[model samples]
Target chain A: MGRALSLAVIFFLVLLPLGVGGSTLFQLPVFSQELVQELLWQSWLQSAFVSFTFTVGLILAVCYLSLWLGQRITAGLSSSRIAPLLAVPHAALAVGLMVLLSPSGWLVRLVHSLFELFPSPPAHWWIADKSLVTMAVVLVIKEVPFLLLMIAAQRDQLPIQRWQTQAQSMGYSVRRCWWLVVVPALLPRLKFPLFAIAIYTLSVVDIALMVGPNTPPLIAPRVHEASLRFSDLASLEAWLGQWLMIVLGAMLFVVVAINQTVYRRFGLDAIGRPNGHSAQRICSGFGSQLLLWLCGLAVLALIVQSVAGTWFYPALWPQQWSLGRWINEWPYAWPLLQNSLWLAVVSAAIGVAGALLVLERQRSQRKKALAWLPLLLLLIPQLPIVLGWQRALGQDAGWLWLLWSHAAFTFPYAYLVLHGAYISFPSRWLYQAQSLGHSPFNAWLHVLLPQLRGSVALAFAVGVAVSIAQYLPTLWLAGVSYPTVTTETVSLAAGGDWRMASVYALLQALIPVVLLVWASRQGNQQRWKSKHVRN
Target chain B: MLEIKHLTISKQQHVFLSVESLQVAGGSVLTLMGPSGSGKSTLLKWLLGEPLPDFQIAGELWLNGKQRDQLPIHARKIGLLHQQGDLFPHLRVLDNLLFALPRKDPRRHQAALEALEAMQLSDKANAWPHQLSGGEQARVALMRALLAQPEALLLDEPFSSLDTALRGTVREWVFAQLKQRDISVMLVTHDKEDAPGTIISMKELTHA
Candidate 1:
């Protein structure tokens, strides 16, 4: 797995140039004619610089924002809230944001009615605009929640409580302890998630294409368009090469130039000190609750707008609210939902089972076994691996194979959730069971499983969420005719119809949202009660 | 009878346990005492063959005249307890005790109920481990270990999570239970005051 992922990273590093070069090499006469004859020193340098800057700026901005928001959320509530938020599928959220942010979206429609400008909804292209503003905003919103969850997972292990308690015992206040002690303690664990978000923002095609600037669409979209539009495998490969190069260069910047710069300047120790910005409490009391409510409202609006019938122009409320789309689209949507659910269930189950096998296999031996593979898999953008795998395996494949490939993505997430528990489990429990004459398998089944129930459930939920959120992989691998919620959501958003897009997006988000809420409540009850109650 | 011969254990690349030799006759209680960081707990882990990596165990461990060092933990018939009593948090106190019994037994539940009844924790048969007081939970932890019906037992700071008042009472109950079961026992603790019969104080280690 480690070797495979390392190869993946190397392949991704070279993707953009290889893709572009491949495209150039394989150009059909028509495209060759359209290709820039004067691909001069200046134009090449200029485009490269812009891509570099945008990727870098985007990476830094995403890392900073995720770190900041994750800190805020964890500080305000129990980090447990993060688990549910993390379970919200990223592509689904991005598609939802497309509908929410578009000029004629629910936001504008609401504003239009409030201003009594009633006859027709304003025709505007705020989202899927030439500006990447909406795309960046969408990225931040989707990623911060995920970063928060990752941070939450690490908080218990990293001496957070000790740091906070020590800070409080000193002259620092509780709020100060949070800023000085907690946030700094959080940043290191957060670095991985931050890096993942950065890589994602750099290489994301589905979301970027859905709401991103279209004229010279982000590099990812360019590769995607080339691959999908042309049967010319060479051209697709060239564009993938180009995409890989640019993303790799950006990843290096994030890891070396950008991250090192931040660490050298601010450092973990300095962060916990009295940074002037720490004094600013952005959300408080009713304001904080209102913020949560607003986020919830945005999600709700996306859900409502997706199902709204005759909800256009000047009306504060939709003239009709119907299950028309849900019904009309049932044939397409139901299978998609079923496909998404089972794929998630099976993949997560497999991933978790594999993780258990691998961990147990490595246990008798003392090697680390690249435990970061699951996390790294999560962080590294899906486009490169999925595309590479898709390219390697011709597009025509069975649905079961498609599901299995999706599990490749889903497995990492499930493994990540379960790995921590598996590692931390008290060895004495196993020993006692053994001494009592329980067989190894019996110990695992009877003693270990009950202890691991919470982790298993959480991992299953994570797997399901990852599988459900998958966009590019599902599209490229399953051929999109499968029409999973994610596949539908991305396609609808790709078409740039905010209402219908939002509808599909809501469907996409709904499945995970329902699953997450139930999982979180169960997790909370386990925390508040006994292990017995947890069972 | 259980014997530890030149047992050495380590954790996370640190040498924690290096006890040269020790022995407990069947039905005897051997309480080990040391300051914090003295590797007393490491001794327990070593006896159970779960020694941390820094350990370079080079001696024989004997159980009932058999060299049990090469045996797996389950085969050694040694039960263990910890500071929190380490009761199965997810199981009812009764079920937690019943867990030690073989599942194939038709009278397992009856035996479990009888065991809980013996410990005077029969009321907690349906109660969760967390619902019990520290003393009650500690009693149940010991009872759970006993239900396994091991020939020997080891404990690592089993009463540390309890308050002092409750600690002595629980300690007495554990010792009394061991005496009643005639199970050879070795206990490790940080506090000298908590040390049990035939107290063995860990000595400073030298390379010789």
Candidate 2:
């Protein structure tokens, strides 16, 4: 029975989407010459450039920041600081970045208030919306925390401190030791996360819509636009766009693979035989802190803008603060908030439960072959698979399809979060429980579950975060029938209502942050209470 | 008596350990000493009814005249103690003991407290597992195992984790408790001193 459930979960979560998407690829109509030319030369080229740049920037930043934090602070503290940034959805972060980096945004207001560089908002800002540079910046900022988190998770498996100590004892400098001994080991382990990051950057839709180039937007946004229209030509374009993303993803994988090989062959040797003078520092702890603070400031800008009254350009502070916008928006916002809450909660619950079933089956079989199966859902480009689901299921979007789509995305994250801890849990503990006269199921429920409460809670919280941040799935599967916080935020921001968008975006970001805090606190409290149990 | 007949353990078609027949009377210890990875712990796991997918084994187990080979781990009514004791970390010392007792018994709590008193751990009942010293944890683990009222007990290097100074005392106490309960015992350890009676080495049991 357990085996059957696990196989069913695998079929539904991993294989079914891939199968549908693959079949859709086979059935795609031939693309028109004009559409093909426009996509290849215009959108695809720009997307490739942006995605490559973003992936490289994200990799460099995450590596430098991870090494710096590993040297300066405990992993625990750094994760706590970076987690809120991760909790903020891509669209919300893009909207916040728009608030901060736009011509009339907070940064301009602050600079104008200080230097009087302009009498009013500047006409040309370096980080302008609807541009490639701004899109890349937002993608990098939004993705750095995720890559850092992936690296941090692998920190325990490597003997980093011992390696550093050994290298330093052999007379290598601290920085040299990190570059030589530590980074090589870490980069290999980070391969899957790098691929996931690369794929996400290549095909992200919501952030692109909010901040990407407008003249010929990136391929993902093009696909998204085409997918929304009902015309046959548009549907063919969308199908072809899906194939384009797959092609781009394959190219990125090959490039990353070649990069890995070349680095292993020559890059390590080049670094090992460095010139007498060490290189100047490329990253500092201060810079990483600044990035985090920038995210915080973006969130702060959202808060201030959401409640601001008659705040004009060149004014650092709002002319007035009022709760009137919130009060007025609440009536319209209440049901969306309720839908978002229940959808996130229910989807997260289903994701975690499904993950547990898969993990239990893996445990019973004593194999880890299925471990990477779930993560394939994460590594593959989500746009095409979700589009395929939309095509296969037709327009009969209901609560069931909405929840299923959300869980389809959330399940991978839940599995990723729980796989390591669950697999490595001591079997002897459960065996001992069984020997104490509890049946297998009872032993698991009474003994193993309690021991795994902290991890399970964390997985559940991450599932909630993933569900709340879902934009494309919620939009494509359910459309406006279920207006989630994510969909509403994106639409509002795109419609040029920063105040209403901020309100929705803030709620989208807050639910995940709140869930994360509550989960971690619950874990800590369980630990503390267990130690001080009363007589 | 706890008896085994025609016990042969193998992996991938090559026999590693075989015992033609063996028996231990109630209140007695049958010691099997072997180096690590010589099927000492494997035999104990098989006896406990754990599924060792990598190995093939044929054996008949009888406890107190009943053929117990087909029984599940819980139904086998056998207790196992390991090197680390493995007291459930989420439960307090007392709660760990109480967990082994039947849930519907009205006096189970009292029974757990008395067991703690017997091990001189009454004052440490409410403490977490990590808060207790190694010796105290071993005592609690033994008491928890015995509280389940098993017809037989298996010890897999249960005293190896304790310091040399604490080892003799804990070993003596464990033997005394098993004797008092008159439970049939099979103990596997590398140290010969852990055995109180006859010791069977792995070389004697292996046919291949």
Candidate 3:
């Protein structure tokens, strides 16, 4: 199983690229002579490498620093207690950040309105500039919460009180106990999550497209545009761009591996709380409050931006608000909304069912492949891999193919959600029913299904969120002929039309909200039913 | 040294647990008895002043002649142990003992050693909490609490989960040590066998 899964991965990376290259090489008009040179210059692959290195390094440093500073102030932070940040989709966040930080962004306007001290931005502003700093900033803000959540989840499982009280009793403050005892223990467990964040940073497409440099964007986005939009398989340059991204992705794997080896050898993250930013320290201390503020502010801006029919910079609020556009938008917007919801539901159902089946059966050495594949899927540059499939399949057979690809991605996440709960579920209850002469299937249906319904509901909601947030697959696989909330939002956002982007963002945010609310209600019902049974 | 006056903990205008008045002078044990779901744990939580947010608490609690209800948790001069004994499962028994004292105290290690020796758990000093038997966990939890030198300790069925053979030995030792230290204690239990001195049933308290 391991060998087969590994071969499958290798085939996509190696053979598929060669296949695309060969096809382009043989094609008449699509293969341009200067494609490689154009890629080196226009694609900004070198600049992207520099920018990626800066963003990944700074974000990793900030993440570790935030954890240390948070541990210093208090040990109260835990992953399960994080704010609604979990539910706020990634594309939604990037759009929000764009609205806040753009040259004509609300923050710039707000400052201008209040103080009038700062000069207006030049025609060519730094937000999404060639430097890519704005993208870096947004990436840090988004990834910080994720790292905090991941660390806190594992940390909570450790014996916090025993360690805290033991250290505090010996004349140490709460901060000391957390730093000296708790942090060292948490570091080893945090290795994979941090790696996930790094790969995520490297391979991220949506955020980079929204706030990153366009003339020369992140490698992932470059692959996305070339293969998906250009649609000229004869374009050897596009295929060449895809190949370059795959190499960069390969380099990231090496970087993470070497970092791991060096870490284990020298124990670099083993000690010392380096002083991070004081403001960031306060933000970490406030914990959920900070997350809520960022989310709330972004949401409020999106709402405002959506409604303002005609509004200029340096205005605190819209001068005029109109429902006319909203009414006009609904006809065009309704279909996208319906498609996104139905697709999410269909994909989530299929994804969760597949997860349940995979988890239920016992596998031998194949389980190791299962473990590696999900993280591999997570770390990989998604667009490059999909370009191979699109190149292979030739422009998306139908919506069913889109649904299938979305489920394939969504399966890992849904499986992760159900896995911990499924494994820990009491086998005794199922066994006891079977011993009483009920068939195995009946016992499972009667005992396990009801018990697992809550997890299934939650997993289903997560699967939907993953689907709704998808940008490239829906755009590339379904083709622009079929639109989802994410595709509509990004396209409008890229066009510099805040009003239309805001409407799509609201609808995008709405789908997840509806699913989560329903999931939560299902959870409550399950609890109430269990209690009623006991009574 | 521990007093709970006019304590009535209510949830959404529905009373869950209430006690008009109660006091345990120094060197005494007040055993609180009740069946499951009868709010025995609720009463202990209320007395410790960290009751669930869902419940409304109205009361005055004084420990060692000071009003403690308004004090922060660490400064309440009160200690708590639950059914599982709640030993810092990650720490060794010795480390757990040392956790009771501030690090600056030069005698913290020695004090921990002495305390373990007195409890006749000297051999298990380096053992993790999970390595110990239920009886040993209870003893360690109790010793850890006492070492903090709390004016009062609220034990919520601390000994009920222990094996029958080890219960009597640990229970007798616990009562004797609290009396020797003059630390007031309230032990909430369903067992009649655990009555150290005066036993006050929770049902009786609610009626009063």
Best by lDDT: 2
- Considering every candidate listed, which one attains the maximal DockQ? 1
Fnat measured on candidate 2: 0.58
Task: For candidate 2, give the docking quality class from DockQ.
Answer: acceptable
True lDDT of residue A237, candidate 2: 68
- For each predicted model, how many residue pairs clash, with residues at least 3 apart or on different chains? 31, 0, 8
Q: Give the Cα lDDT of each candidate.
A: 0.66, 0.79, 0.68
Candidate 1 structure quality by residue, lDDT tens digits, A1-535: 7578657855653353134344454545534433533331324344445545666667666555544554455422533455545555666666555556556556666666577563554555545443577776666556656655665556544666677678777867555676555655555545555666656666677777676776545666656766666655446443444555445645544563457446546755675576444334563333334434435666777777767888655566788988887778777677777887787778777877877776665554554323655555555555665666676556755577677777776676666555555665666677667766787887888777766666676767777787787777777767645658787777776776666666666666776677666666655655554433222
Better model by DockQ: candidate 1 vs candidate 3: 1
Model 2 chain A: weakest 10-residue lDDT segment is A526-535
TM-score, each model?
A: 0.86, 0.90, 0.63
lDDT of prediction 1: 0.66
Candidate 1: residue B193 lDDT (0-100): 72
Candidate 1 structure quality by residue, lDDT tens digits, B19-56: 67677987788887768767666667777767456556
Clashing pairs in model 3, backbone N/Cα/C closer than 3 A: A30-A234, A166-B99, A169-B101, A169-B102, A170-B102, A170-B103, A171-B102, A171-B103
Q: What is the interface RMSD of each candidate, in Å?
A: 4.1, 5.4, 20.5
Error of 2 at A48 (Å): 4.9
Which parts of model 3 have CA positions greater than 4 angstroms off? Answer: A1-48, A58-62, A65-83, A118-131, A165-192, A228-234, A258-270, A273-283, A361-370, A419-455, A517-535, B1-208
TM-score of chain B of each: 0.88, 0.96, 0.94
Candidate ranking under lDDT, highest first, comes to 2, 3, 1
For model 1, the docking class works out as medium
